[model samples]
Target: MIHTHEVVNQPPPREGVDEFATDAPLVEAVARWGRAGAVPPLSEVGVHVGSAAFQRDAELANTHPPVLRSHDRWGVRVDEVEYDDAYHRILGAAVGAGAHTSAWADPGAGANVDRAAAFLLFAQVEPGHACPVSMTHAAVPVLELAASGLRDEWMPRLLSRAYEPELGGVGLETRPGAAPRPAQGGGRPRVAKRSALVGMAMTEKQGGSDVRANTTRAEPTGADDARGREFRLTGHKWFCSAPMSDAFLVLAQAQGGLSCFFVPRVLPDGSRNVFRIQRLKDKLGNRSNASSEVEFEGTTAWLVGEEGRGVAAIVQMVTRTRLDCVIGTAAGMRQSVAEAAWHVRHRSAFGSLLVDQPAMAAVVADLALESEAATVTAMRLARAYDDDADDAERAFRRLATAVSKFWICKRGPEHAYEALECLGGNGYTEAFPLARRYREQPLLAIWEGSGNVIALDVLRVLDREPDAFDAFFDVVGEAAGGHAAFDLALAEAQSIVREVSADAAGAPVRARELAERLALLLQASLLVQHSPAAVADAFARSRLEGDGGTLYGALPPGVDTAAILARA
Candidate 1:
């Protein structure tokens, strides 16, 4: 439902949405899922460590024949509440932008989150279906955040979100030698209270992807009125992707270090005080998924943990989101490309069906390769998450979360563009959903944590586990040893990292990019050698660099670069 960071420059897709018809089947699928039943009671929502539970929510109580179900706490009574109106409007925007725009997602594990978002949308608009599922419990910290930014004098609502029939149920992926315990003890929300029900809250500012150095601040606030519970946040948040949601699980620095807390936009006394939505800036892709520039003016808040533990509290949210973004974006492109290919097989061109054209065939082949590689990589990360975090859920909470998120989120969009190109001009236009799919994938890569930050996560981990780093590098060394072209490029990239890291005044950005590129190269090697969807080395590089190589001539001529790169 969120657009990645890379899409900031384009007009939001919602701005122009009258050009196409919604797929009846898709809408029906959403309706069918909605009408089937509510997911389950809060206690029953499955909580695992690794795998996803991308299934239909059981069903909710019917209020309006068509109503926004999960908007509140699986249907909080928002009608009497007085909060900023922005949150309510965002839902309509998301759907409007979706029409005629290429921002649609396909059915795939990678896009499990998008599917969940869509179900929410369906619940929102459905007339008779008044109830919604419990993504709120999944997204508690986020809901807390939204409520915080609002008023200063209302009783806190202890919401209970449906827990059963999770979309892609949970599991863990812990790492070895993790800290023994989280100081918060049992602060992590229950499965039914997870942040998902409220949508997700992600932060990956442009200049500070390295989350540890984030500039936001969280300070303790003494209570005011009896109902004015006290806490304070002062910082400049660049992007709250779902700006209109019930909550935002924000990260800010405190006396100890980086930590996170839940914030809301409304106070119980019917006020929109602490925070204000700056702008729903026009963006390149997921136009409906609004991102905002928000300034916290000593916002009243509640601390989720010790002052310095904001990062720790929020890391759980970010990591899970990061990995999920990958799945969502990649699934989007898979659906888009498959849709495009299906069109090509039947649509006629100059002389015959487009599939008959050799140029189109080659692009299809590339999409196939990229999709398979992304899928396998995503599954690997997911499974690893389940295994590693099996028992040590206490500390290794973000282990599987960070790894899978880092890889999948960035990679989903990378290949989404490749899939987009399979259709020429049709892909570029709102005439098809390719553009939207391309735009949506990057929401993962740049949000949560940009590709660079995630790469650094790997670097930080590897820095400590030199043996692990060595194992990875040894393979990289062997793979690139003979390929002079790859060797030179990679070595050159490494040298750039060394030089950047060597600088002190302002070298982090460059250093981060180098780290990201390094990670991509490492994964590329891993995929090439072992992945079933392993792309040809030269072909991938050609696409990466926009080099006019062998596949260039083989590919369809009209594919857009923006579209192609968007997939990656």
Candidate 2:
């Protein structure tokens, strides 16, 4: 019998990009920013993360979301969360690659940049698991404020590269070389472990971003010693992600005011703390990770910092996580562009490859420009963290983090949608990764803080730290020498700043617009300073000069679509 059915016109799979070897932009960004030494390890990590096996694991983890076991077979309230094997394997790979604790393990010039690059690459494979990794990394700074005795007891275990998912129960032994330390008042010692993960529980139902409005109460247990003061917390966390983590940095009202506390899952007597996981959140994406609504009824916790300074103690951690938000969004953009570019290059239409068509090329080039700008901006911010000791750099970071996080994350969902359209119907299905990426993009913008919160933060920095405004202009001015469009945009931003400074009441109303301008000017300045002639000129003309339309692929006539797409 003659064959009547065939699968013709179907594009070949867009695999074999050698995510590590073929990423020219990532390679260039690392080397140009003084992270050349980290190239070898980062390259290996990229390859592993991009491998078929690891990608399979990433999909499996998301498909099989974590399950909440409220009780065991005997009906005891355990509140344990069980995850798929793929979730553990991916997290283990991230921990083993030092993506979580690399900066702390080796503090030097390019350590933060190196770790940021590695994190960006790993996040491309699986962003859901990145929550715990980011929390663990950001938790280090907060933990340092604890008493030396408390710090010494937990820091070593947190720094471990191993991923331990086991929760301490009856007869769980302490790790080797670490002795069980007694709780305050010489109570039975807590079981010390070789590896641990950290999480955050903020934003109660009544107060989402207004953590000051939280109603959770933390009362002293009346047991104090050199180790630390103990407290019993009673509250409900509206959104507590990674509930299986060993410990959480929570905010609760104390006698003085809102205070930071370290709430652990396992108590000193090798018994589970009074953490009641009401239910796991049914999120839109990030299914591989579990976010829970927890109720704490006299949960055992120790004060992390002084009372009435909870925001101050946790602000640094928030800053670090916000930085990750930028990095994660940039990774999403890169993945979207890569998938779009691959599809167009392989698929043919109208007697030619889609990539060769002028209209399609314009769209691909525009997407590439967005991706490159985001990559460079994120790397610059990472470099800023490396020089925190410098007053000017610190000031620059204070303002720049808010601006970049506001723009880059907000742009992610739209960019992902445009890239998905490039694949036609195939991209809309779960069979492709772009659909998942589109859903994941919005979470980053909403995770650390939403649009208004970030924009208002920019105004806050301007009002509180005037030096940061100067520092921001100083950095952008370095790249403004020759580009007329960038210079004009910079001057416009200065004028807005001056006007906003003159009228304090109107600043809140204009915060989002001002934040967008500041971010665009900064991104244009970075491209002008470091990117290629085609990329820089196109971005400056289209974005800074306001010569482009609202949608993607609307670059003006002089823009070099071929060169930009080639770089992408």
Candidate 3:
């Protein structure tokens, strides 16, 4: 019986290897983006994230989804979300690695690139924990802009790498003489290993992306101090993720209009706020992280930004989160490709190794090409986020982020599905990562904004910010002479842009088309400029030439599948 039950022809667990070191594309992208110094630390992060221990935590965290403990024993209203220790361990590791606020903390050359790379490595293994990490990172710019006094009081704590799991245990106290330092060893230590994670609550059931339609109300408390004007918010939030987060940046209708507010979980007095956790969302995926519907009944809050300018206030955060969506999706693709490649290399079928088979090779190589394109585009966007970036870089980021976010995120689910098929039945089971990945990928597309919302945003930028459009072309134009297919694609994109720009009223109908072309051209341009001829040529032929199939494994004839697979 034991002999008959023996297992064979399976791939070894993908662990212990450094995720950053193995990913040539990511390493090269980091170096090219001016983060050469970050490689060592990033490699360490890679090793930690890719280890078997980390993978176990990821599995456990999701298996035991977060539980919303709305009340304590004796019926005390706690409004708490209880997570498995695995979730805390994963979140702590990510925070301790400075994946959240390293860019803002360091604020110099390659800071954002470094953070983005680290984020990708962590998200690759466990995307559920990345929600709070990303929200925490995005909240920094908004805090700096809307509430200087609150920023002074909270920024240090927010930037701390320590993951404080206890919501009300640590007081909102900043250690004396503590300031943001460079990202060397978690960017300097604080009084203790204490930090805060931030969350956001914007969309209501009535208005998913249309935040303006929110009916939450905020009444003035007639108390103005260093923390800005105070308010008492009373409304229900339909979707508030990371319910365990120490604070949240929320939008509500104030006397003037919709305004931004900072609502802390625990007051300065060390007591919990009036946050009632209605229930946790039974999400399809991302189970480890708690997304909730909460009722804020006369919750003590402080105004952030101006009254009636909530949308304007959180714009920076929204942009940053959108960029993270691209990074997260790219990481998912990388994981999918790596898992598929590993399986194909080890699991022989029929007469030969799957990788050596022409059909299978084409699929793996195509997946690799897609992954590389997404990785390169994500890194390039991160590079443009440097504090000292030139005007052109900034303009490029403004338009390109939306473009990549729309196309790359939308492509994630299909990419995951294709990769999952490479492993046959094993991929469909929870025992494998691809099944989780397939479910996780769709959330990224819906996270920041869905396809339509983002497409319209591209149009908005084109209409309002002409520099952004030109800047996007300027970057793409650099690879103008590299390939005939790319050149033709670029020309086609320009023609479409002209058509969309010519008819403002009709632009929304063609927004998806415009976004898809711009995204492909951008990916093609980056591949041509930075990637190998094999990778670039294959991508341009299959993607830019419009000869590729709707599914993977259909690279044009004569394309070097081996070269692309080598990168994978």
What TM value does model 2 have? 0.95
Candidate 1 local lDDT, 30-54, one digit each (tens): 2332223222210021111001211
Q: What would the TM-scores of all predictions be?
A: 0.53, 0.95, 0.95
Q: What's the lDDT of the predicted structure labeled candidate 2?
A: 0.87
What order do candidates take by TM-score, descending? 3, 2, 1
Cα lDDT listed for each candidate: 0.42, 0.87, 0.90
**Cα lDDT for residue 514, model 2?**
87
Q: Write the residue-wise lDDT of candidate 3 on 175-231 in tens digits.
A: 686452222122112223267899999999999999999999999989877788999
State the local distance difference test value for candidate 1: 0.42
Backbone Cα, N, C clashes tallied per candidate: 106, 0, 0
Quote the RMSD, in angstroms, for model 3: 4.9
